[model samples]
Structures are given as C-alpha cells and as structure tokens.
Target: MRQSDKKASFIELGKFLSQFSEKGNHLNPEVKNNDRFFDNFVSLIELSQSHNGWFTPEQVYFSVQSWAEALTESNLDQWLSRYDFTNITSKTVGLILAGNIPLVGFHDFLSVLISGHKVLVKTSSNDQKLLPFLAEYLISVTPEIASYITFTDGKLENFDAVIATGSNNTARYFEYYFKDKPSIIRKNRNSVAVLNGKETKEDLVNLGEDIFRYFGLGCRNVSKLFLPKDYDFKLFFEAMYEYGDIIHYEKYANNYDYNKAVFLMSRFELLDNEFMTLKEDTSYASPISSVFYEYYDSADTLKTRLEADKDQLQCIVSNAVITDSIPFGKTQHPELWDYADNVDTLDFLIKI
Candidate 1:
C-alpha cells in the first residue's frame, strides 16, 4: 500500500475513535465501518477493566480522546513532513508492545506502517483487544492494510528489525536476543517535575493531572518532584486535593493504604492528605498513590543532575525553570513527534 493510503486509513481510524469519549459516545453517520465496529468498540471499552484492572473506563477514554486529537491530517502531515520515504524499501518490523496504559505501543505500530513497512505486532496480553480491533477497522477502510499488519501470540519470527518496550530486566534479554537486528529497545523510565515555591494554584492543580493520570501507570506520568529548600507542602497539597477523589477507586485506595503503611512502619516522615502521600526521597520511580519529592538548592546543579540521568527520565515538567522541560499537565498528552525515551522511532523504521 502507498504511504498516502496508509495515512488516509489512520485518519479514518482516528475519526472512528473520536466518537467514543468519557462524556458519552456520539456516532457520526459519515465514519466508515461504524455499523460493523462502533457498537462492539463501545462494549469493549466498558469491558476493558475486566481484562486489566487498571484499564478503567475513564482512563481508557482519556487515551482514546488524546489519540483522536493526535491522528489528524495536520498532525500527521507535520510529523511525517520531516522524513523522506522515497528510497525506502518495505520491510517487516516486529513490535513487542507494553500495556501499562491504553494503546501504549500504538505509536510504534503507527510508525512502522506510516514509514511504508509491514508491522508484526505482539500485543501485550494486558492490551490485546483494543489495537487489534482498530487494526480490523483500518483493514476495513483500506483492504491492503490487512497485508501490512499482523498479530502473533507466540514468539516473533521473520522480521527485518524490531522495536520492543519492557522493564530493565527484559530489555537486557531483548538486546542479546535481537543482537544483529536494527532495533530500539526501551526500558523503565520515569518523568519528574521541578518546582519553585512561586507556582500559581492553577499550575499546581494542572500538575495534579500529570501525577494522577492513568493512576501513574505510564512512563510519562510525573512520579517525582524537585522542590526548593524549605518548600511549603500546604499549597501543593491543596492543589492536589482537586484529584482527591482518585482514592475512591478500589485499586488506587488499596495502593494508598498499603504504601502509606509501609512508609509509616519504616519511620519515614510523610506529608499526607488521606488520598496520596508525599515523601522525601531521591528516587524517580515511585509507587502508585504516592509521589516522591527531593529538595534542590540550585537550579544549575539540578539541571546538571537531570542531564546526567537523562536516560533514567522520560520527561521533565516545569514552568521554564529547567530548559527543555515540558509544561505542567502535558506529559500524558504527548505530540506525535514526542518520541518515547527520546528515541526517533520513525528514523529507526526508515533506516531498517
């Protein structure tokens, strides 16, 4: 299939996804294959939590809405405009997806196909339903796309190159396994926020979205905070109160109770607000229902530390206190070109 045809099919898939939202499902008569796919898609969204306890309707819908906004003609054109596909030879690229958040690996899948290559996807068992369902929709829109996409349940085989996402442990195995193939192997990384005491209430409230979105399951979620010395937790806690209802969910509440108890027993000082706890720590990866914070004396020194640990971080959220840091609350709403782990996935696919 031509690249234009693949882009058109994805745009159609985006339109189809635009119909479902947390507010309500609105069917558009003009969307192709809705009669065959729309109702079933709604049912799948409702049943997503059963497949994975973390895949709540609200979280899934947020992901759907984010993608609906991303896969537009303008966004696609702008993202793809930077690449040259003239001399490309189509090759099969295997994707081992991660299921931490809904459609976590969709970008890689989209990248391989948009670069005019076949995609052999091994969907994470936690996210097996959504992508394949959309793939079926894509094939329905452009029949040729069927030959370009495949899903395998067993070991991946017969692929020219590979892109895989996993934890640090599994990444080691992937490096050894795909030793000879061109590859991008990803591992666990966390996002952090650098804060000065002068943040407005609105800014901090938006930061709550970065902290609490998807229950902090995604690599882009802010799991750590860098605060100035003697930083006041009162306003920060007040801003976070906007998301206090997150504790109402059984899974999150359980994590809150358990992690809080573990901290209390360890005699660590905690700043708590009944729903989530704030602890003083240096680690970037924090448990669900908790956020770790550290005190920084110098912005220059902190920047140097972050730069030294760039590979361990995915995003740095701030209000321009740190150079190249993303704005508050926007970590989960990454653009098409905001490649994960700062790796250029399209360039990798094209070269392979």
Candidate 2:
C-alpha cells in the first residue's frame, strides 16, 4: 500500500474512535453514564492504577491504531503472499499479558490477529474486558478474524512466536517456559524528559499532559524531569497543577495517600501544595511520593547524560536539541510512524 493510503486508513479508524470519544461512548459508566467499550476500558485502567494492572482503554486505542495503520501500510494480504499463509494454517500464538500499565498486550493481540495467527490470549485480570470487546469489534468489521481469536486463562504450547510481557523477574519464567520458540519477551522500562529553558509555556502545558495523563501510570508518561539547576519550579508546577482536578478521583487520591505515607515514613522531604507534590530523586519511576525532578547545570550536559541512558528510555519528551532523527515532545501527538519501544511491531508481524 502507498504511504498515503496507509495514513488515510488510520485517519478513518481515528475518526471512528473520535466519534466514540465525542459521544462519550468510551468513558466508564459508573463514572456517570458511561458507554460500553471505552468506558469499560477506562474503568479497567483506573482499577489497574491501584493494583498496577496493565491495560488502559487509552493505551488499547493507541495500540489499535498502531496495528490498524501497520496492517494498512504493509498490505497484509500482499505481504502474507510472500510468506505463503497457506503453509501456516494451523499455527496458534500465545500471548502472556502484563499488568504493569494499561493495555500493553493489545499490540501483541493485534500482531497475532492481523498476521493470520490464531491467538490464545492469557489476559491479565486487570485488563480482561477491552481486548475481548476489541476482538468483538474486529469481528463486527470482518467476522473471519473472529475464528482466529480466542481468550484463555491457561498456558498453551506450540506456537510460532510468543509475545510475552512481564517484569524482569517473570521474564526468566517466560524465557524458560517458552524456550525453543520464537518470542518477544518484554521487561520493565520507563520514559523520561529533558528540558531546555527555551521551551514555550504552551509546550510545558502539553508536557503536563505527557506527565499527568493517567496520573503518570503509563509507560509513556514522563516519570522523570531533566531540568537546568536552579530552574524555577513555578511554571512546571503551575501547568501540572492545572490538572489537579485528577486528585479528586478516589483512585488517584488513594495512590497519593499510600505514596505520601511511605515517603513520610522514610523521612523523605517533599515540596507540595493541596494538589501535587514534588521532589528530587535519581530514580526515573515515581512512586507518587513526589514527582522526580532532576537538575543539570547545562543543556549540553543534560543531552550528553541522556545519550548515555538512551537505551533505557522509551519516549523522550524534549524541547531541546536532540539527534535530529528523534521526534520531539513525548511523541504523544503520535503519528502512524511512531511505534512503542522504538520498535516497529507491525514489521515483526508481517515477517512472522
């Protein structure tokens, strides 16, 4: 397919989702009058926030678009002709889902289905609803895909590839269990940001979305901040605090209380207001104890330091100089070209 065709298809899908968003069909019902698919997704994600359950409706949406465009771009039928899909008619792929963040498994789910592989999905209880709902949606679009999709609570063997996501601890389990099979075993990773004083206030506000959206529970959330030493926290906090209404959510408040209590018990100092808290920490992932805001004496030094840790970072939300190849601003204003983990998952699917 031509790139233009690929983009058009994605925009079409985005329009469908936009319609869902507009009608508030995707929000949780108990929150008010929630819709079916998206509302269930949001609730599942909100639940996952407490248990660290993986899969959010938003992440699922992102993954869905990623796969949708990928299939469009690769022209699955044409690409599969090269691999001779007829020869692989009996393959079943097992996906071991993760609950670290919301809807991390949907990408693998899309990969399996779009590639004509029967998927035996072992969903994390934290995210049980949306994938099935999405599978049902796909079935509505093309029922043939339905016969290829199945959800299971138990383990299965003999698959072409196993796409398993878990913590570093369970990674060994995945490797040992799925030994001798093709697999993409993912472990924990976090995203970060580097700020140059030149960033506009408007950009900082959007960066606030990059950080505060989902209350910083997403893999794509900016868990850490790289700032010039002595930089004022006023603007950053102001923009972030604007989203303070999120604190009213009982789930977020619970997390804030647990995290804050832990910090107090540890004797960790924190800066705060009624809405949000801040602190300096070397860790990339925050515990809600406080936002981990780091400082560099200069932008050049910050850039160099980030380079050393580039492999460990997933999406860097930056407003400063970067290797021109790297897209800026959290890539949250995501385009079809942006794939998570900096890896083109669809490329893997077409090859598989």
Candidate 3:
C-alpha cells in the first residue's frame, strides 16, 4: 500500500475512535465499518478492567479520545513530511509493547507502518485487546493494511529489527538478545514536575491531572515533584483536592491504604491528603497513590542536575521555567513528534 493509503486508514480509525467517550458512545453513520466494529469496541472498553484492573473505563476512554485527536491528517502529514520514504524497503519490525497504560506502545506500532515497513507485534498481555481490535478496524478500512501487520503469541522471529519497551532489567536482556540486530530497547523512566512557588492554583490543579491520570502508570505521568526549599504544602494539597474522587476507585484506595500503612510502619514522615501521599525522596519513580518530592535550593543547580539525569527521565513538567519542560498537564498529551526516550523512532526505522 502507498504511504497515503496508510495515513488515510489511520485517519479513518481516528474518526471511528472519536465516537466513544466518557460522556457516551454515539454512533456516527458516516464512519466506515461502524456497523460491524462499533458495538464490539464499546464492549471491549467496558470489559477492559476485567482483563487489567488498571484499565478502568474512564482511563480507557481518555486514551481512546487522545488517539482520536492525534491521528488527524494534518498531524500525520506534519510528522511525516521531514522523512523521505522514496528509497525505503519494507522490513518486518518486531514490537514488544508495554501495557502499563492504555495504548502505551501505539506510537511505535504507527511508526513502523507509517515508515513503509511491516509490523510484527507482540502485544503486552495487559493490553492485548485494545490494539488488536483497532488493528482489525484498520484492516477493515484498508484491506491492504492486513499484509503489513501481524500479531504473535510466541517468540518473535523473521524480523530484521526490533523495538522493545520494558523495565531496566528487561532492557539488559533485550540488549544481550538483540545485540546483532538493530533495535530500540526502552527502559523504565519517570516524569517530574518542577514547582517554583509561583505557580497558580490552576497550574497545580492541572498538575493533579498529570499525577492522577492512568493512576500514574504511564512513563509520561509526573511521578515526582521538585519544589523550592521550604515550599508550603497547604496550597498544593488544596489544588490536589479536585481529584479526591480518585480515592474512591477500589484499586487505588487499596494502594493508598497499603503504601500509607507501610510508610507509617517505617516511621517515615508523609504529607497525607487521604487520597494520595507526598513523601520526601530523591527517586524519580514513585509508587501508585503517592508522589515523591525533593527540595532544590537553586534553579540553576537543579537544571544542571536534571540535565545530567535526563536519561532517567521521560518529561520535565513546568511553566517553562526549566529548559525544554512541558506544560503542567500536557505531559500525557504528547504529539507524534515527542519521541520517547528522546530517540527518533522513524529515523531508526528508515535507516534499518
């Protein structure tokens, strides 16, 4: 299939996704193949939590809507305009997707195909349903796309290159196993927010969205906060109050109770707001239901530190106070060009 064909198929898939939301699912008769796929898609979203407790309907709907906005014709064209696919040869790129959040690895899947390559996907068990369902929708829209996609339940073979997302431990295994083959092996990285004690209550409340979205499972979610020395917690906690309903989710509440009990038992000081806890720590990866915070004395020194530790971070959220920092709540709303791990996936694919 031509590149234009692939792009058009994705655009249709996006329109199909735009119909489903937290408010309700509306049937758009103009959307192609909706009569066959729409009802099943809704059923899958409702059944998502049964497969993975974290895949609640609200979270899944948010992810679906995010993709709906991303796969527009203009966005796809802008993202691909810089690449030259004239001399490309189709190679089967293997994808080992991570399922921490809904459609966490969809970008890689899109990159492989959109770059004039076939994709052999190994879906993460936690996210098997959603992507495959969408893949079916894409095939329905463009039958030729079927030849370009494959899913496997066993070991991956007959692939020229691979892109694998996993923990730091699995990264080592991927490096050793795929050493001879060109690959992009991703490791765990966390996002952090920098507060200069000058942010508005609205900014901090939006930061709550960055923290609570996907229950903080995504790499883009801000798991830690960098606050100025002696920064008051009064306003921060109050801003976070908007998301107090998050505690009502049984799984999140269980995590809150368990982690809080463990913290208390360890005699550690914590700033608790019933729904979430803030702890003083130097780590980037915080557990669910809690956020780790650290105090910095100087913006210059903190910038230097964060720059040196860039490899361990996914995003740095700020009000543009820090270099290359994303806005408060926009971490999860990454554009097509916001390459993960700061590695250009399309560049890697085209060269291979």
Candidate 4:
C-alpha cells in the first residue's frame, strides 16, 4: 500500500476504534449479558486462570484510545518523521508472545502490521483473544490486510524475522532455537518510582493506581521505590489506603494471602494493608509481591543507583518530575513506537 492509502486506512481504524471504545459502559454486558465484540475476550479470560484478563471496560476504553491516536494517520506520520522507517517494508515477521501480562502481544502485532509485514502470530494460550480481536478489528477497518496475516500455534520456521517476549528462562530457549533468525527477544523487566516526598496526596494516590492496577501484573506497575531518606511512611501509606477496595478481588486476594503467608514462614519483613503486601526487593513483575521504598538523598544518587541496577527496571514513573526521557506509568499500554525490551522494533523489522 502507498503511504497515502496506509494513512487513510489508519485514520479509519482510529475513528472506528474511538467509536467502539466509547461504548465501554456496555462492554461487561456485551461480554456477559449481550454477547458482542468482547464475547471472545470474556471466554479467553475465563479459559486461562493464570492470565489477568479481567481488565475494566474503562481501561480498555482508554487503552484503545491511546493506541488509536499513537498508531494511526497523523501520529504515524509524525513518528516516522522523528524516526527513520524508510527501510521497513513488507516482510514476513514471526511473533512469539508472552502471557505474563494481558494484551502483551498487541504491540508486536501492531508493529508488524504497521510496517507492512505479513505476520505469523503464535498466540500464548494464556492470552489469546487480543490477537484475534485486533485482527478482526483491523479487517473490519481494512479488509485488504487480512490476507497478509496468519495465526499459528506451532514453531515459527522459514520466517524472515522474529519478535518474542518471555521470562528470562524462556528467552534462553528462544535464543537457542532461533539463533540464526533476525529477532528481538524481550526478557523480564519491572518498572519503579522515585518519590521526591514533595508529591501531593493525590499524586501518591495516582501512583497507587499505577502500582495496584491490573493487580500489579503489568510490566509498568511500580514494583520498587526510591524515597527521600527522611520521608514519612505513614502519610504515603495513608494515601495508598484510600484504594483499599482494589484488593477485594479473588485473584488479588489469593496472591496477597499466599505470598504473605510464604513471607511470614520465611521470616521476611512485610508492609501490609488489609489488602496488599509491600516487601523489599530489587525486582518484581507479578502481582504476587511488591518491593518497598529505600530512601535516597538526591535525584543524582537515585539516578546512579538506578543505573547501577538498570537491568532491574522496565521504566521509572514520576509526574515527569525527573525527566520525560523514560517510559513511566502503566507499563502495559505501550505505544506503537515504544519498542519492546528497549530495542528499536522498527529498525529490527527493517533489517529482516
């Protein structure tokens, strides 16, 4: 497709998505009561107990909006102007998706599709509806692209390139298996935060949303913190307590209770509400646990420590208080150009 045609199609896709997402209030019913666009999503989530696919309709609404704006028409044009995409074109790309987080495959799928590639998608049984939903939606907006897409559950062979996301252990498997293929294999990562102690109660509360949303299953959830050395824990915990109801869900309660018990048995120190646990650690990527804050003297010190432990962080969340150069809050909703595992996805696509 020509640039103009691609642009037009993206615009239509955006408009369609915007319209669909506005009906967020109807999503639960559409899935549970009415059976509509999200019926497959409900079924997929139900089939996979390990996957945290119980995202609020409101989250889906905002997420679809974020993606539509970031991936389509003027946004793509602007992004291309900022980054070189001349070399990325129609290629056959294989994707091995991760199920640790919901909708983790969407970014790769969008990248391949937007780059004019024929995608061979291998869905994780843990999270399947997203890919199918996306393909269906894209076909609804641009039927021509449907022929270029294929779903696979087998090994990806004879593909020009591969993009895969998995745990560190699984990453090793991928490296050994697809050694000769051009690939971007994303390993495990977790996001953190730098608390200046100057944040308002509302800011802390918003940060709580970032940490607890998705029950902390997302890569973007703030698993650790760097606070001012003399910061007051009581005030911070008070703000977090406002969100106590978030922990009432069965899955979250199970994780909290199970992990809390394990920590007690292991003689580990824990910070707890009636709902969640805050323990100390370098990294955490699942809802099962979260790391606590250790005070730092200054931003520079925090930066140095973060650099020293850079491998442990996926992104750093602040109200842009430090710098806007890094990925922050809600790690799950990646933009089209956010690039997985800190690698330039488009550049990788171009080479293959």
Q: Write the per-residue lDDT of candidate 3 for residues 108-160, one digit (tens) a residue.
A: 99999999999999999999999999999999999999999999999899999
Worst 10 residues of 4 by lDDT: 25-34
lDDT (tens digit, per residue) of candidate 4 on 1-352: 6545555656665554444453443333311213344555445434544444455444445556666566566667765565555766677889998765556677777667666678899988776765677677566656787777898877886688899888889999999888888888888787778877777888787778778766676676777777777777777788888778866667667777888898889998878876777776544453454456666777887777777876766778876645753333455555666765577776667667
Task: Kindly report which residue stretches of model 4 are placed more than 4 angstroms away from their true locations once superposed.
Answer: 20-62, 69-72, 83-89, 283-289, 319-321, 325-334
Please give the ranking of all candidate structures by lDDT, highest first, separated by commas.
3, 1, 4, 2
Query: What is the lDDT for 341 in model 3?
Result: 99
Candidate 1, superposed: residue stretches over 4 Å from native: none
Give lDDT: candidate 4, residue 107: 71
- In candidate 2, what are the lDDT values of residues 1-352, reduced to their tens digit? 1223323433333333443331244432332112334555445434533554223344444544444444443444444344333433446788888654445576667556645567888888766665676566555444455567788876765567778877678989989988888777777666777776666667778877777665666667777777776777777766666577767766667887888778778888887765566668888778642578788887667678777876567677775455532333444444434555666655555555
Error of 4 at 301 (Å): 2.7
How many clashing pairs per prediction, in order?
A: 0, 12, 0, 1
- Per-residue lDDT tens digits of candidate 1, residues 1-352? 7899999999999999999999999999999988999999999999999999999999999999999999999999999999999989999999999999999999999999999999999999999999999899999999988999999999999999999999999999999999999999999999999999999999999999999999999999999999999998888988999998998999999999999999999999998999999999989999999999999989999999999999999999999999989999899999999999999999888787
